[model samples]
Target: MSPPLRIALADDQALVRAGLKALLESFGDLVVAIEAADGAELIAALKATPVDVVLSDIRMAGLAGPEAVRCLRRDGDGTPVILLTTFDDSTLLLEAVEAGAQGFLLKDAAPEDLHDAIVAVARGESLLQPVATDPVRARYAYRDQDAPKANFNEREIAILRLLAGGYSNKEIARSIFLAEGTVKNYVSDILDKLGTRDRTRAVLKAITLRVI
Candidate 1:
């Protein structure tokens, strides 16, 4: 049998950490190998133990979750990290994605949803909680209504939609039967046309401007 996926849990509240650890252990396919009260402790735990993924609370007292993910990315650590937050704030969610989090989930997510997020992130798939989707859509609704439409070809539009749906470049290429390098070029064009610096902003700008 394949070994269980090792997860590191980080949260400032002791009870919250205990509860999350218990819940992850209950999944049978998951094992909590490290626990930390804040992002610094999380980094230390990572240095001490090899883990498959990290699950961190977004608003801890020290080195917030997004910052930790950024630090990991800056250091060339590609381990997938998932961010948990209490509020369904789209801005924070986007920041987490930009900071290299593979998943964004609310603290009150269902046990099954949390488990599924862990699994998805481990597989290099991206996910955002369903409850958080509408608010983001709503937040961009006014912008969508007011913004001038930018020109996008059919393929670019399809790719933009997939990007907004959290599909990685490899996944997008697979879905559309395009070469990965070609997809990268297309993504660059999309970003240039949207006047955004990165994929997250490109997707948000596309949505806000109704370009996709």
Candidate 2:
């Protein structure tokens, strides 16, 4: 079997970091290969040891999650990040995502959800919880409510639901027992239908448009 995916764990709270490390390792498919108390430590540790995913707190003593994500992207390190927050702050969530975080979750999220978020992000999927999604949808709701919704067939709607669930094309393909390339095509069509090239935005637009 392939080795477990390496995870970089970072939080200012030592107990929180320890708890997260234990919980993540308990999954057997994930391993906490690096641990840091803050973003700077996380960044420096990453230079010495590469990891598949990063689980970090949004607020830290120095070099917060958003800035850290920006630094990672600036340095061309495309490793996915899952930012953990204690409260539902849409602004901070958006900042982290805009800075390049692939996933955002509350610290109190269920263990399975946290695991799924990490795995999804590691696979290059974008997953934003409702705490953030609602604001975006409301603010960017369709301009013309009377405009007919895009003619999305049932199959496309199913795919869009999975997209909203934060499943990557590969995962969606496997779940539906369809070919990955076919799923990619479906995603392309979804984006085309939604009139947005960004998958995350496409999902949001679909919700705002009430198509999915």
Q: Judged by lDDT, which candidate is best?
A: 2
- The TM-score of candidate 2 is 0.82
What tens-digit string does per-residue lDDT give for candidate 1 at 1-212?
88999999999999999999999999899999999999989987898797998999999998999999998888788888989999978888877877888888888888987887788778766675533455455555544444356478889999988877666678789999999999989988888887767666666667666675
> In order, what lDDT does every prediction score?
0.82, 0.84
Question: In candidate 2, where is summed lDDT lowest over 10 consecutive residues?
Answer: 141-150
The lowest-lDDT stretch of 10 consecutive residues in candidate 1 is 141-150
Query: Model 1: residues >4 Å from true position, as ranges?
Result: 130-205
- Score residue 119 of candidate 1 by CA lDDT: 82
Best by TM-score: 2
Tens-digit per-residue lDDT, 31-59, candidate 2: 99999988899999999999999999999
